[model samples]
Target: MAGKLNILFITADQWRGECLSALGHEMVKTPHLDALAADGVLFKRHYANAVPCGPSRASLHTGMYLQNHRSGTNGTPLDARHTNWAKEAAKLGYDPVLFGYTDTSQDPREEDPESPWLLTYEGPLPGIRPVAMMGTWPTPWTDWLKANGYEVPADIRYAYGERAPGPEYEDGAAVPRPLIYPKEADDTSFLTDRVIDYIAESDKPFIAHLSILRPHPPFVAAEPFNAMYDPEAVPGFKRKTTHDEEAAQHPWLEHQLGRKLFRAPAVEKKLRRMKAVYYGLMSEVDEALGKVFAFLKESGRWDDTLIVFTSDHGEQMGDHWLLGKCGYFDASYRIPLIVRDPRKEADTARGTEIDLFTENVDIMPTMLDLIGAEIPVQCDGASLRPFLEGRAPATWRREAHWEYDFRDPADDSAEKRLNLTLHQCTMNIIRDEKFKYVHFTKLPPLLFDLEKDPDEFTNVANDPAYLPVVLDYAQRLLSWRMNHDEQTLTHISLTEDGPVTRRAARY
Candidate 1:
């Protein structure tokens, strides 16, 4: 085996930042991840730069913000010119292996319009070597389920806890049910098995990106897990008692509530049950990760591997009366970030937690920094290598910033519904220690004093007393946007002898 250090980058979809027991989450118990944090550095205030799957993963892979990457939504094409971590790693002589999916919508310019990849946003990113592409509807896993003697549904989505297996509830159930497949053949277990096999068969140092899609949707779990949590014991939602109360906060909240996407059902029992199922799914993923950790240790690669565990974006999961990832709420943007660097210099920083703000874009640069690769000029993220080595950067970011583009090119539903232009269906958020400011393209702004209203129930944008704070954050957001404009080739210049280049580190 080549002696290059291995990179194990793992991502869980729609996982909340506050769901980890290691981070003092009361309801969820994440023993596997907790152990991981015991040997890793945890970023307490990490956030994703974009929303949904495709766009968030775009920021994560390219080390660029939503504005820079321009892959704003699912099915939106990622610009072919931009280089991702996988493409960069390939140049460094490491074959980036994807065990699960990247949720990258291929650029239309590089593909035939009639191609199958163009029909869906679930395609792998350019330059990523997908060993097994398990996504929203994993065909490979479904085929494995069939071979394992389970009755496969005509539409695999049904088997994802979307509907009951009985003929009576073939379409869907009023309440979700356990998946038809057993625990052994479920998505998490299937992906884990494939990852273990890949590690076992590999002889060379590998760059493995394992994206786990549990606790993201369908909110269902198999056997022992489905019955593991008691719905009654689940923590209460951190939201107003009624959806109407939340909708009254802002125009966007009203739009989201009217769409009925984030608004929970009226039934208390159903909502709690769904939350319980989501927690169970998290536990299931944690269990699956435990196996992978064991594989790394037993295979004698634990000390040589750099492990990164995070999520693309966070799920609302009934927080703020929301179920999906949208709006400027912390629940939809803040996510867990744990990095376990095996270098001896990082020993003192082990089990430590950093409260400084970090974003999803920083991940690519951090990975690149660890592997001794040059971070690209286009990346707007900074490396966390300093924190990993028990030292904090002198000029670290003081606030967390994120952008969400709600435009739908295929159909301008958000614009039409919100009574705004296509360009107006966008927003940016700037969150610091004491306050969070949300600025929409055309809609009224939102300001929350997080210290007083941590649940973000009250919006103080119109309050005359808080105008100074609002103005300060608004200017900060604007300056941040202007400062981070794409620098792909701006750092290079033509010269008589050759091109003079200013590296990303210089800028």
Candidate 2:
């Protein structure tokens, strides 16, 4: 509480909120993250505000909702005027460093038409310095792999899928094999090494973002981790018996299921195998993080550091007959959140599980708050400092909110398929203790009674009995949006004398 606190912000890609062993997950064992939660406070109902990587991170880094940020898709550019946590921290004299990618799409207004950064959405956040950046290309990791005498692939994207020398089938069935690279040379390990090296050499208090890409795509794990969990032992999918039955839920669900990319494999054994590999990848990441946590304690930085462990978004993992992060389901938005404030004031809250609704937008304000930086007026979320100090805020949100835009500007695929305009290819969700309402721009709305049908297998919006509940939630969602619209200059007024301005209250 006295000196500048070191910040270690860690994000694992495509991690489900319920997969942690600390939360009683049946199969996945994330011992290192569970230990971090023991020293931190874990929010049970935390959610990402948007889907995929870029849009979710835009909300995460800027503390603004997707509606305010307007970065709806992966390739959508983030507005240049927004002030992010990195920029706010930089103002307070802390050099924010990134060990991996932020998945930021640079605002086109700030770049030339031919600029290479404009070509991809996987750009770095504006204020952070990249120590070892990993993205779609992952040049740094690939270069390291090549330098270490490993046979690099002709196409770098295939690096992670490269399997060890072995038969492709076992007992007349296809199985996931370990990667050709050893565990020490894996991408997760490389990023962890960079973070450890940076912390070892830094002389002053540091702010480092360690973004680990795992439990994501190319789901194969290395060596021992590949066999860590038995495929049959993993929990079964939470979905209807057949894809056709699941797709009947809604028009959007039907559209998503029709696409091969989003649909789960038709083969049941393959789907189970993929789920097992995903858990294996999670275990590998957990082990890598164990090293970082150990190094922090050994280097005497553990007590002085504030660590936040989370994910950009959640993975569907064959849930509801889907394989990727998209749509309006909780499986795509609800993610893990664990905040470990090193100050003595936070000790009382350690190991506590908060059931409150927290979103990815809260991350920016929380980091800024811990560092004593000004939370920008553009931020739509409140700081979690009060919770960290063992007290709940007077007014806390009871519901979680998220938005998804299915529009494809390049090909107009969603527009053409859904028979709607680009703007109509979007949906917003408001979910609380008992009910969830999904409002689409043009499609039919979906309302689920979470208590009666927690799996969201049925929609009750059309039922006369639930019509009032839908109306109430719709009004609440509208009010929530109206209240959070961009406020950067809304607090300032032009006067005859001089400008009079008031700071925006986060809550």
Candidate 3:
């Protein structure tokens, strides 16, 4: 009992929880995850704190919401002073090794002589050593191809609507193609190989976060899995209502096609290929995970190691006509979360599915506490150990908090004025069980009833009948902000008339 258990955290980039068979999505076969679920707990109601890579990862690592971290934009980097999970783990005398990235936002002021991004997580916490950082992958696979003389021509760095071969990637190397042996050659497969190797050594109890880069974009899968899922077999998302029927309800989806990028005949073909490739990548990712799991079992560490499976966030696959996560819709925030408590708790494993809402923030503290490490008292996140112990505490919370900042680009001086740009101003979200309230600063807020309109086809934020519901969620949002966010005097300022200020404040 005194010896610490190792932590194997696996995260898939932009992976939807519904894509795997374990989640009842019949199309994709995930035998590896299905068995893992059978042996442990699977969360049925887990949500990401933010959509997209940078901010979502910030929240997950710090156990602080975006409101607190203030690395508000994709390009905005988290303050170097922040505490991260790996740093925390090190404090417990365990080596907290980060196998991949945290997708931390790039800082605005680059080329700093002492760059914060280059440093370790807020200075090591203890027992953890942030090593073997197989820096941002998939891109590296393209690099590996380049190093090997293959002319791959797709920027897997970012993928949006109707993309064609571009400057960075010219040939089909970056495009979807059949690999000789997917299990042995794909990018995800290589990453799994690294993980298995790390675990095999098991020289000491280690905390390894094996983050995967596929299922994100470029949607290209390796080999047989590339043609594995028949687009015909996978049904298109059921349309509850027509898009043209609702004007101004969701214009974001329509603008995503980028008609300029693809000429006449290529649009539909691009869409078909994109979806097929995305699912293929999912299958390939699952195969890699299967190998990792098999190694864990063979090493006899399966029961003792606590495994966590989740993703930074979800992707919007033509949903609402959007290609990626740019809105507060369910397709963007609903991520997969599964916690396999240390095998020592095997017999005591109680419930398999937890319906209560859980946010990515809860993960850090929960993991910290489970491993007998100290959970910071000030963290806004609550440890979920009780739920795993088969005792749903009476005070167990049932909701999650999410926020996005929408800054108005029209304000040129916005960055200097408030220490952030317009992309940093859109603070809005879906909350409670059925209501979504979006506060767009100068713009009108949005409200959606998830229970009544699962498709979010209506904007009830302005409806007087649901005004109370909006206010209730609004106050809860504020409470969440107050608990998580931290602002400094420099971040705010006083205006001539009164004390008008510009800063990132939670409440």
Error of 2 at 277 (Å): 0.8
Q: Per-residue alpha-carbon lDDT of model 2 for 454-480, expressed as tens digits?
A: 989999999999999989999989998
- Candidate scoring better on TM-score of 1 and 3: 1
Model 3 clash number: 22
Clashes of each: 0, 0, 22
Best by lDDT: 2
Q: Residue 439 in model 2: shift from native, Å?
A: 0.2
Give per-residue CA lDDT, model 3, range 445-489, as digits (tens). 678888997777788977899999889887877766655555334
Give the alpha-carbon lDDT of every model: 0.87, 0.90, 0.66
Error in Å for residue 27 of model 1? 1.6
Structural similarity to truth (TM-score) of each candidate? 0.95, 0.98, 0.80
TM-score of candidate 1 on Cα atoms, chains taken together: 0.95
* All models, RMSD in angstroms: 2.6, 1.6, 7.6
By summed lDDT, the worst window of 10 consecutive residues in model 3 runs over 256-265
Q: By TM-score, highest first, what's the ranking?
A: 2, 1, 3
